[model samples]
Structure formats: structure tokens, C-alpha cells
Target: MKNNILFKQQLFLVLTAIFFTSCLSNVDEEVIIEEPVSEITFNVHVKPIIDNNCTQCHSTAGGTSPNLETYAGVSANAARIKAEVESKRMPIGGTLTDEEIQAISIWVDAGSLNN
Candidate 1:
């Protein structure tokens, strides 16, 4: 009877380990799909992101430098904007979602078009 109990306990431990190993082994890594750069334009995608996350600090009426209130300002500073947001360094008090950051990156990659 003692041997039977010991064998059952060992079996339970082995089963638990196998269960966890199988579950964890099936976990998938996150994949980020890049949108066509042409589909991601300045007005349609990038502006709203800037408007929501950046304009509070970088607006025309605000005290912040490098105002993002216009296309020209944003397009001109596209590289800096992409770098800062990608590093999660800008916006100071706010956050940009992965999707928003991706949009900004693609926009910059597409030559920071005014469209």
C-alpha cells in the first residue's frame, strides 16, 4: 500500500510537469505585420496619433518646442518623432500604442509624405 501511494505521487508529479511543458512549448511569439507604407499616409494615420498623444505638449499654442500642429512641422521632424516614440522617450506624460508607433514608423519610412 505504501508503494502504491508513492508510485501515484510520482505519477502525478510527472504528469504535472508534462502538462506544463506541453502548454509552454505551444506558446507563440508575437508577430508584428508591417502594413504597406503607401497605405499609411500622413493625414489618415499619422496625424491622429500625433493629435492624440503629442498635441497636448507640442501644439501650436503650447509652450513646447517643435510644434506638431501642421503637416510641414511633422513631416520635417519625422525622423526625430519616429526615433523618440520608438524608444518610448517622447510624449513625456502619455503613451503611444504599438499600432500608433508602427504607423509613425511607416509614415516616416514612406518619405513622410504630406498626403
Candidate 2:
């Protein structure tokens, strides 16, 4: 009788471990489906981020700034823009969404085209 109880307990523990392992195996990993970098453009995508976020202090109107309000200005400093945004250093008093930062990064990676 004692051996039977011990055997049942060990069986229960083994079954419980198997059940939990199966449950863990069924859990799906989260996959983010962001827009392709090729789909990101300067005029439509990057401009909006720079206009709404960066222009606050990186424009001609902002004084002593890099003039991030225009295509030439943004393209000229595309690498720096990506670096600053990735580091969360720009936009000064405000914040940018992950989507916005990804857009800027994609634009720069796509060669900072005028489009």
C-alpha cells in the first residue's frame, strides 16, 4: 500500500511536468509585422516624423539648428538622425513612437532618397 501511494505520487508529478511542458510548447512567440523598409519613403514617412518631432528644435526657425524641416536638411544628416533617434536623444521635450523611429531608420537605410 505504501509503495502504491509513492508510485501514484511519482506518476502524478511526471504527468504534471509533461502537461506543463506541452502547454509551454503551445505558446506562440510574439512576432511584430512592421512595414517593410522598402515601403518607407522620405516624403510620406520620414517627413512627418521630422516635421512633428524634430522641427521643434532642429529647424531654421528653431535657430542654430540643423534645419531638419526640409528634405535636403534631413537627407544630409540622415545617419545622424537615425543615431540620435535610436538613442532617444532628439525631439528634446517630446517623445517619438517606435513606429516613427522605425520609419526614420528605414528611410536612412534605403539611402535617404528624396522620395
Writing each residue's lDDT as its tens digit, candidate 1 over 28-68 gives 99998999888998889999999888888897677697999
lDDT of 2 by residue, 25-48 (tens): 999998866798778989888898
Using all chains and alpha carbons, the TM-scores for the candidates as numbered come to: 0.72, 0.71
| Cα lDDT, all candidates | 0.91, 0.87
Stretches of candidate 1 off by over 4 Å are 1-30
Off by over 4 Å in 2: 1-30
TM-score of 2: 0.71
- Provide the clashing-pair count of each candidate structure: 0, 0
Provide the clash count, candidate 2.
0
| Residue 74 miss distance in model 1 (angstroms) | 0.3
